[model samples]
Target: MAGRVKFGVVGLDEMLHGGLLRASICAIVGTYGTGKTMFALQFAYEGLNRGEKVIYISLEEREELLRATMAQKGWDAKVFDDRFSLLRLDPTDFNLAINSIKSELPALIRSTGATRVVIDPISLFEGLFTDESIQRQEMFGFIEMMRDEDCTLVLTSETDVRDQNGSKYGLVEYLADTVILLRYIRSPGLTEVHLALEVVKMRRSPHSREIKPFEIQEDGIMVYSEASLF
Candidate 1:
């Protein structure tokens, strides 16, 4: 955490008390269409623009498809290609993909000199192991690899359907330095997205205690200064 990485335009920097620190692992949990991918991808794009080497490890989508999605979100694939590295690894096949991730993560970091990384939809690997304990172990192992490489990691997880609460999968919340929850609140006939930033457990820094409202547009995710009543 020598040089803090600011998520500038998103207005999340203020919430984080200046942004996420280097060598820290953070989780972003949201349900489908809550803009989780957009948030994580935008962070990756931000890293590229900041002259920091980034590696986007995609799980649910292929590399090409991911690039296209970013393009539609107003990100230039060419610009991203020029500065950052992208590695797509889908764990739909479970053991094989997870093994590759465990084995190749360090090597990828070394090769790309990546200081920042985005593991989109990390919850995809939840079913890889039968036992809950084993699942936790695997996730911890992956996170450990990121820590060893001194990389700023952003992981995306799906909120449990049964329990609107954040914890359902493994000990992902326990292992992460920051836990961000994105949810859709339906009021009347309107549906809106809200972003909640919980320092959860910042190692040495202070963070916001409020769950702020964040809007996603062509420019990307932006947190509101204060809550507004409808």
Candidate 2:
């Protein structure tokens, strides 16, 4: 494995013992308002800062909306220009999106020599598959193909309210090389809600198992490695 890719989130790269392994797929799973998208954006932004070509594919939000969000964060989305590309695919047209991704993504990566890629809310795409078997097969293939590319990938997924695990489909956690879980934990009285992030799994890398507190600030997501859940 080559050098790890920094998450760009302050204090997070250290927890992973440097950063995410190169060309590996990491699944960022969380519920709504848990800052999953922010984490993904931070990863791409960090790549851009390092002069690495980056690509972001959003299945839930429009490109304009993402740009607006970036602008709110004081990041000039236009500054990166040609080095960064944000593509939004309609989740409603599942077949077309899946086909396009499989057929066109490789070419895009090759043409741009992108070194970082993010798939925001892959859960929506997985929901289109009615059969569990087919879902697993297709997901496995997709992950493998992404890994084959010379890029580090971050895929976001939604978690159910009742489920303890972070992924809605559950298969993404297994398919990905690393799994990062994010959730909102309420105090005993339900009066205080705290955001926590955990590295559930990181193949071939020794990562922190502790659940640490985090915050979604104007700049981006910040993980407190030294803090405890309580």
For each candidate, C-alpha RMSD in Å?
A: 2.4, 1.1
How does candidate 1 score on lDDT? 0.75
lDDT by residue (tens digit), candidate 2, 1-230? 57889999986897899999999999999988888999999999899889899999999989999999988988887999899989999888977898867889999999999999999988988887899999888888888788779999999999966795758988889998899999888988988999998999999999999889999998888889988877
Off by over 4 Å in 2: none
lDDT of 1 by residue, 1-230 (tens): 58687765456788788888878888887777777788788888888877888888888888888888888878786865756777777676776778767887789788878888888777876666778888878777777777888788888888777865575584677788888777666555667434444445565678877666667777677787466423
For all candidates in order, the CA lDDT equals 0.75, 0.89
Worst 10-residue stretch by lDDT in candidate 1?
192-201
| Residue clash pairs of candidate 1 | none
Q: Candidate 2 versus the native: TM-score?
A: 0.97
